[model samples]
Target: MRFSILASGSRANCVLVNSGGTYLLVDCGLSQNQIVDHLAELEVKAHDIAGVLISHEHSDHWGCVESFAKIYGLKVYLTFGSAKARDIQIDNVSIIEITPQNKIKIDDIEIFPITVPHDAKQPVQFILSDTKVSLGFLTDTGRITPFILEMYDSLDGLLLEFNYDDQMLQHGKYPNKLKKRISDGYGHLSNRESIEFLRRVNVRELKVLVVGHISDNNNTLSKVTELLCEIGGEFQKIIVQKGKKTGWLCL
Candidate 1:
């Protein structure tokens, strides 16, 4: 399987996973033009995309999904609550409502959607497999759970959320209420929280660790690197890379 983070940040978030000629997009936050450009870079045609899976109703995750799927003639899979909350009904697009923990198959790829704690209606992340290798993707989550650890424990690759730095968020010019919301359990995960989650998970078979959904205003690459290094031996074991700017990764 080949995985690529077309973009991951507060501005927009999208991921592409390809397996056995089946291409799936986890989100369509980017504009149609931007998504097309990124797909071009990957040598994938927009019409060739098998499906678009949404994580939540947030604009940075599914804002352009309706238009993108309509234009490309692609199916979109998202929770029913997300679709209703976001008013995601559009002509010429196939909207398939999926439930959390339900497994769906698109061609040769198997998709497992797991529930997540986010300030959205029925948010979820994906675990994909082509029978040969498995890849787990989690982002925009606030707090980590034991169920998350169990689901992502032994994946070949992981795209996990590392949204903010605690210090920066606390000291930055943002309002106190906003800061609290971000640090709250239903907000975003801090760098420390991400590292703690990683340490608690079984990383024996985890090869690639790609940090995603980074907050440009409240986090820095240096801080994320420093926090990861603090994990001691576990930090040096996996091939870690930050998403968005790192382009594509294959395993």
Candidate 2:
């Protein structure tokens, strides 16, 4: 199986996971043209995608949901509330009302829609697997919910979030309200928090841990790399994903 993070940040979030030529997209936050262009850069075509499974109704996540589905005739799986909020009822869409702990399957993938604590209504991160490997995606979450921690205890690969650095976000030039929102446990995770979570997980068997959704105004690639290095050679053995780039890894 193969996985890639097409883009990640406050601007947008999208991930591509393919196994045995069966492709799935985690989100459609970028524009249709942008998504297509990025895929082309990766030598992938639009029609190659089997479906799009959304994490929430946030525009940063579903910005191009309707357009991508309409243009490609691809199937979309989203929560009922998110569908209502976005007013997205596409003919090719598979609107699944997912529960906190429900496990469902689509085509050749097994999906576990693990609930996450975010401001959105019933937001979830995906754990996709076939017969050999399991790829877990977690981002845009408030904090490290125990459910997520337990579920991702032993993943083959993870697309995790390390949104901001405490010093940078606090000392940077931003409004007080925006600062509060970011620092809130309900917003994004700092680099420290992300590292802490990585330490708890079983990183021995994990092939890769791609850090996603970083704040450009508040964080840097060097800082993220250094933190992972501090965790010792286990995570350093894998490649890291960037905020606005494509990172592909095989498991």
Candidate 3:
């Protein structure tokens, strides 16, 4: 299986995951043209994508889904609440309603949508599994759930978030309300919180760990990486994804 993060974070979030004969995307935040460019950069085609799985209705996650689906005939799988909130209307795109805490199998992959504390109407993080390997894609949440711990034990790769540094958020130039919102339970996860989760899960086979969705203003790559390594042990490789770029990982 191969996976590449086309981009991640508040600007535009998307990930292309390919396993066996199935090609799936976690989000479609980028426009059709931008997405095409990134896929082309990785030598992948737009029509090769079979499905798009959305985490929520937030603009950074669901912005270009309708246009992309209309262009490529890809089915979008998301929660019922999120679909309603987005009000996305496009033909040839089926909506597969999935709730957190339930496992849904699509073709060759087993998807477990784990519930998370996020500000979206019904945000979910995904843990994807094939027969041999498991890849957990989780972000845009302030807290992890018990279901996550179970998946951590089996994951060969993880696309997790280290959204911010607490001190930066507290002292940065952003407004007070925005800072408070970021630190809330429903907001993005901090570097400290992410490390705590890594320690709690204690994943050993975690080969690829991408520290994703970092705040460009509030956190630096070096700071988040240093803290994560301090708690993520010394085995797993960590990569940070930024802008309209690609980070490759094999599982």
Candidate 4:
């Protein structure tokens, strides 16, 4: 299995995962044109994507979901709450309402949706596995939960959120209310929180660690890098930048 971070950060977020040549998109936050350009860069055809998994109804995550799905004739898998929140009822696109209990199979990959705590209604992250390897996609979550630790313990690759730096967020110029919203239990995970979660996870079998959803205003790459240095290991580490496409990493 292989995956790429097409875009990440507050502005937008998207991920492309491929298992045995079967392509799937975790989210479609970018515009249709941007998505096409990025896929072309990776030599992937947009129409070849099998499905799209929406984490939530937030604009940064679900901005172009409907248009992209309709253009490519792809199936959209999302939670009932997310669907209702967006009022998605497109006739041309197939909307597959999935719960945390559903283990959906699409060609060579099996998808497991796990509920997460976020500001959005019924938000979820995904764990995708083929016969041999598994990849976990987690972001837009407030705090790491016991269920997340249990379910994501054995992933070969993980695309996790490293959204903010506590110090920077505390001292930044943003309004207090917005700051509270971000730092609150249902907002986003800070660098320290991400590090703590990493320490608790089983990293012995982890190969690729892709950390993303960085805050452009409240966080710096150097800060994230310095913190990550403390958790040095043999696993390959990647820091995804905002509005950038990373090269494919295989598991």
Best by lDDT: 4
lDDT of each: 0.82, 0.80, 0.82, 0.90
Q: Rank the candidates by TM-score, best first.
A: 4, 3, 1, 2
Q: How close is candidate 4 to the true structure, as a TM-score?
A: 0.97
lDDT of 1 at 8: 77
Please estimate how well model 1 matches the true structure, expressed as its whole-model Cα lDDT. Answer: 0.82
lDDT of 1 by residue, 1-251 (tens): 97888877777888889998899998888889988988898899999899998988888888688878878789999888898898766333499888899898989899999988888888998999998889988887889988888888878888887888888899999999988888888888888888888888777777677877888788877777777677664322232333444456776
Cα TM-score of candidate 2:
0.91
Which ten contiguous residues of candidate 2 have the minimum total lDDT? Answer: 234-243
Name the better of 3 and 4 by TM-score.
4
Model 4 RMSD, rounded to 1 decimal: 1.4
Best by TM-score: 4
Off by more than 4 A, model 1? 89-93, 232-244
Residue-level lDDT of model 3, residues 1-251, one tens digit each, is 77988888888889888888888899889888988988888778888887899999998898788878877877898987788787754333476788777898878888888887888888888888888888888789876667666666647888888899999999999999999888888899898888888888857777778778989899997897678657745455555556646556788
User: TM-scores, in order shown?
Assistant: 0.92, 0.91, 0.92, 0.97
Model 1's TM-score against the true structure: 0.92
Q: Is candidate 1 or candidate 4 better by lDDT?
A: 4
Q: How high is the lDDT of residue 197 in model 3?
A: 86
